[model samples]
Target: MNPLLCGLAANPALPPELVDRLLTLALEEARADPASQFADDLLHGLADRADLRHDQILELAAHSDTMARYLAYGGTLDAADVDPGSMPNAAVALLDERRGNLAWARFLATHPDPQIRWKLASCPGLPQDAVDLLAADPDEEVVKELALWTDSPVTARLALHPDPEVRIAAAANPSTPLEAVIVLAADPELTLKWTLSERTDLPQALYARLAADPHAGVRATYASNPGIGQELIRVLAADPELQVRRAVAKHPRIPLDLLAELVVGDRAGWNLLPRIAAATPAELKEPAGSRHAAVRMLVAQRRDLPPHLREALAVDPDASVVRAVAPHPGLSEELLRAMVARHGVQVLAAVAANPDASGPLLEYLTQHRPGVRRVLKEVAEHPHATGPALLACLADRTSRPLAAAHPALPPEAITELLADEDHQVAEAAAGNPSLPRAVMLELMP
Candidate 1:
């Protein structure tokens, strides 16, 4: 490379092509002596030349280190060089350089293509004056982009737009002014009215009003949003549309009482409610003894079941409910045993953790069943549960824990068993670990 050519390559104002070839030569030789620029200057010149195909120009631009290219650009790129398709890419580069100048941006704002115009309007660098002009643009596409605006007046104008699509777009915009969304709730079009149902963007006042909207869809749309009022949820739970009803059934906001309505009686006779009812917590249940096996089945899984619910469900005719109630945490030990006679020891596991289980049941658990004993042992050692019911079992002499239980209990029951003394009592305590450690140690020798 000639010394003059080399020096010219370093010149910031040199024609882009010669600078590019010189940069390539410098990079090819690994000339770190202020010469190995990531891209030759000519490629940037090619990128700026508008007559070249965009892809070809991009191909050249892609070679330059992005940071280095912006450094090379040094605030000289005019609006003419900003291509419509490539406008975002170049604008991003310019913004990154903090070169959000009027000339570079003005070219983009007034670009012939709406795509470019929209992108520029959406850009954070778009001047407030430019945003005001673009927000009022008549094109729906331009109007829609204006909703991205954070300014209340600018976002509101588009939000108040007469077009349903534009209003829908505005309602969906995160920056849409709250006042603007309120205006749409008053729109007559079903779509705009329906847009009021969405809980995500609409204000609380607007969302509540929409829930009462006379249009079924508008009210139904409100039902779909979890933020809809609880009273409104009750109303929507009865919505005629199966789609709306189904949506309510799945919404966490829908009232439990309303869920019962939705979960019962087949509007279509097949009964979608049965599947839904099968998952309710026992605390939500109203039936002392629910008829549906699935509903009764769900009642068994609730940890918060009230005593009335537990007592009522304890005698359920369904063996599954009996089995479920047998191990219910809320059920008394005596109640658990009664349920067991109905559903058998297989059902006893349900109440194994019940703090109210009788010592006799614990004694029975230690004898023949490994699974039941394992559960009883966990109840004894589990951090959250106090195993007072296991006192008699832990005090017994011959008690033996089921082998290979998870969260194994410590060696301490023998002392509690020694204190127990009764033959049946001692045997039951041997398997239970909640027995007094000192009593077990004294009995060890």
Candidate 2:
């Protein structure tokens, strides 16, 4: 019943000593009960071990359990030893289970069952020769599975496949040559053109072609590519479609000056300020002082703001701006305390969550706001939480789970929390690294 042995047996790769230990345990279990599943699983693990002799593999395969026998035949048995006549179904199942085994793939290549051939087509790590054979499969579904193999030479053949769906998959594959991509871009189907527009590696010439595409959807897709040149970006910026312009505004490489203009001039672009705020910190100074509270609210959340900007936003007339700034670590102590006094409990909870809160400030919040349990949970999890603050959190049933997992919680309290009836409390206690080794052995499955 050792979980480590079961885990080791399930893994295909194992260190020599661990494999020896697993085999020893399996043999001991098999002595007591000859048909133990763990012994069979361990035998299967040994069958996959490259260090074992061919005869040892044969012995394990001969006595393996039904499931292990099937895997062994597919994985380790030579083609001559397999009786194709006696076990037709097992032969097919073996092929399905075999991964990257070239001999098995060759044997199954001509399997009359298209379904069996389909399995070979989808199996990963198969030899390139085997993949090339599967690509010409008469069944479209089997051919479709070949599309998933990006490195295979067959992917080039799949690009020219008559089936548009298969062609689309080939276009999306990273291995598809740039020449094939150009052909797909010119496909009469708008969907194929749109899919090609999303590829980041497309050359600048393709971007220009896609930018002027008659379909707005294709142009919009090109607008989102960060690699699109500035000239193409400006053209897309003036695109009549609001969606296309919005995509232009969000491009990471969009000129900062242009982004600032879009924020003020385009109504659709205003909603994208959060994204713009991340790239253009210096350009946002004017937007931070915007008369519109929504624009100011998004700017207040930017961590790159100077201390002076944080202080200014902290005292803004909008409560939302104050709430957004409350959790910022750089906010002045005077501003945090003033906001806590003027605003409601939610603002106090935010301040409590800020790791930079001084020990004196945490103490004041813990004592003065005894009834606010939400703030207590934040204080309990804060890295700066003191012993007294954590104790206050542990006393409340509503906040005890967060407190139980806090690294600052005393070792003795954690031991007590391990026995807590609440599943969440016990689960949190189990995850704490400081939990004694003996306790972890009992709690971890």
Candidate 3:
């Protein structure tokens, strides 16, 4: 058998004689015809094997292919024998692949090429001294790479570096110490302050300070920061810039009274009422009787409101308010039925989807509102849905997917759904625990 063919077979246990013959032929051919495909194949095969002689290793390193050089030099080749300057970038990368190759690492550490220095910066096992040296590298790219090493002592130095780009990278690194971040926060560059404002651990004083920043963009960040307490929220709520005040309205921690004031007073007309309505029950009460229908609608959706207030909002003249109250868990049964009778199917759909919806109401909506697909789908999946209601939903092809998955679906309906033309329907049927043992077994891969 040809030695090259034997090597290509990848049989690690090939006889020693076969290995020696293959190496000899491959080296000779590679030297005579450097571009030979057969020689390249044999060289690659021998590159991964540990049986290469010292001369064979050197021969492979000197080969024209960079890949062949990387494979050869990646092994036990001495640093002196390998010329780092002449080697291609790819070959240089291969040397750093293995950890703790101190000789190669130290030689490449100062290897004039910035690309080599950049790669070294990412090595976790790189020595601290080498990291320090790279941190001060003239090239911003090299320094930027070092900025990512959060634990490096050099990150603090880079944070204050004259280059805004380097400072920005350091500021963004979560590992950069708080002291360094505070300095970056005050940096004249709006971009640096913007990056620093995103840090969750920003000091309360900083939040307050950034809130009054000359630039709307910086104050906007402060407005959006959840850590901003009521004091900062109050300040931002009254900001001259409508955009900043709008951001305060969306803030999760803004005082309820302040949000109400913004809803009623801010002339920006940004539609901040929905967010205020979503506030905790305690907050919702602050804006309970605001003239804005949007604000009133949100207040009506709160479950914590007193019965009188909820009942009054439920019967409010505004259809949107009535619709909002329809989904409130604390909504009275009388009010829900009244809303369903008075409002259109849109309001009824919200009621049908509410977990607090009564069984009788769900049945009523299921029977009378079958034309609305959303309402029917919600009714089909309702925990209180009646047997007849689920059957009605299953009968409609549009609502079958949701109906087929309902626990109330009968075994016969499930069997019928198993053969549904819609794959989603069939898949839902397969996953239903009520499916027969034989049916489940058939669904197995």
Quote each prediction's TM-score: 0.37, 0.55, 0.54
lDDT tens readout by residue for model 1, 1-445 = 1322322333333344443454455444443443543334333333443343444444444443452344325544433445423444466455435564554565555667676567556555456676766766666687676665434456666766777777777776656667766666666773555544443755566666666667665565667586666766666677777766766666655555566566556333222233233445543555435556545555555555677776877877777666655655656666777766666656655655566665456556545343454455544543333234344234332222221111133335333333343443343343233444343233321
Worst 10 residues of 3 by lDDT: 1-10
| Ranking of predictions according to TM-score | 2, 3, 1
Give the TM-score (vs. native) of candidate 1.
0.37
- Report the CA-based lDDT of candidate 3 relative to the real structure: 0.68
Ranking by lDDT: 3, 2, 1
lDDT of the candidates, in the order given: 0.52, 0.67, 0.68
Model 2 per-residue lDDT tens digits across residues 1-445: 2333343343333345555655666666766788876666556555666665565554554453343345444466554444443433344455455522356666666668787777667665666666777777788787776675446767778888988888887887767787887788778872665666556788888889768888887788889787688888899988988778877877877775566555554444143343555645566777678876656766776666787777888898877677777787777677788887887675778788776888677767777653587788788788887767887887778778777767667777776776787766765664454555454444323
lDDT tens digits by residue: candidate 3, 290-378: 67776686576565666777778888877877877777677767778888778777587878877788777877887774357777788
Model 1 off-target regions past 4 Å?
1-107, 119-130, 148-153, 160-174, 187-191, 199-218, 264-445
Report the poorest 10 consecutive residues by lDDT, candidate 1: 398-407
Q: In candidate 2, what residue range of length 10 has the lowest lDDT sum?
A: 1-10
List the pairs of residues colliding in candidate 3: none
After superposition, the stretches of candidate 3 with alpha carbons farther than 4 Å from their true spots are 1-177, 186-190, 200-220, 227-244, 253-257, 264-286, 304-309, 394-399, 442-445
Off by over 4 Å in 2: 1-157, 174-179, 188-190, 201-249, 253-281, 363-377, 391-399, 434-445
